[model samples]
Target: MRRVPRWALLSSGCAPVVLTGGWVVAGRLEGGSYDPATQTISVLAADGAAGAWVMTAALVALGLCHLVTAWALRPAALPGRVALGCGGVAALVVALFPAPSSGGSLQHGSVAAVGFALLAVWPVLAFDPDGRAPWGLRRVPCFAATAVMGAGAVWFLIEIQGHGAIGAAERFVTFVQSVWPFMVVASCVRHKRPAESRL
Candidate 1:
């Protein structure tokens, strides 16, 4: 019922924020392992398999969100939209790709990275806040710190709720990438709305 600006941004204006959130959460949902027994389809621990499903669903939703946002906008806004949407799609692709044995080599290729990229890009692309960049050393670093703290809070909330599926680092990433930005964007929408991206 609420015609929130957040909806406007996602459904029309800068859409990367929403897409990235979905993708990041999706990555967190993925569960995988190296199943040497089958010698096929890679393998991971039980939790990995479960996480994969969650991540997959989230990514699929994110992909759909990107598609909707991509087509909804005018041609004038295509470039930024493309960047944002591509980031989400790429995150999904990265997420679906098999992990290395050590799970170290391509960690940067994770969905969170794509989400982070989108968050970092949206303000500049949209210039949401009187057509100027929202992030400076101060605003961005403060927000980043807030995001880190928020993620820790989520980690604690998960423990309180007994929904412990993700590792601490993974939980932190989830909080920072998905929940934190989601909240920040909402705050921006409520008070600042979106601004034109600066040149």
Candidate 2:
């Protein structure tokens, strides 16, 4: 098994924090005007929004973090790493093409959809063919993770169509996506420690 460097934890771990913190702070900046239950995170990054800059910066950081994590995750399959990296790139593009203040932007929605799909599927793609992989990267676990993320995405889409808790749905899915990398990295590190000690 290839060793996963300890520093991968930092990059993967920061993803959820940056995303959650960005939305929280941005929501606060929007003050009474923003309803997180009904509005999406992209709204916070939209043009003329009070905390657009903060949200944009957070998104950019998230993208970089994913890119770094993908590069460091040597144990995962190459296709999985590429998908994760592409997801990161999608995030950067979403940031660059911020949503419109009053309505949806085709470019923004398309990029975000692609990012979500990539993030959701990357876990299964990362599954180890052999049975010796870490817990998080194992076939069953990876499949479970992908299933949950896919369900979350469905919920998000349903919410969007119904004009329901769009923000809540988005946050739930994105949070799962952001934290999954950390779980995989942690498992790899823990699995490595035992082997190292034996050696």
Of the candidates shown, which would achieve the greatest lDDT relative to the real structure?
Answer: 2
Q: CA lDDT of 171 in candidate 1? A: 39
Give the Cα-based TM-score of candidate 1 against the true structure: 0.42
- Candidate 2 is scored at a TM of 0.97
Q: What is the lDDT of residue 107 in candidate 2?
A: 96
- In order of listing, the candidates' clash counts read 24, 0
Which parts of model 1 are misplaced by more than 4 Å?
1-48, 73-77, 100-102, 107-115, 128-199
Q: What is candidate 1's local distance difference test score?
A: 0.42
lDDT of each: 0.42, 0.93
Model 2: clashing residue pairs?
none
TM-score of each: 0.42, 0.97
lDDT of 1 by residue, 67-170 (tens): 45444332213344565567557546654664554444355345445554563454234322333223321245434554565565555446535635334434
In model 2, the Cα lDDT at residue 154 comes to 94
Top TM-score hit: 2
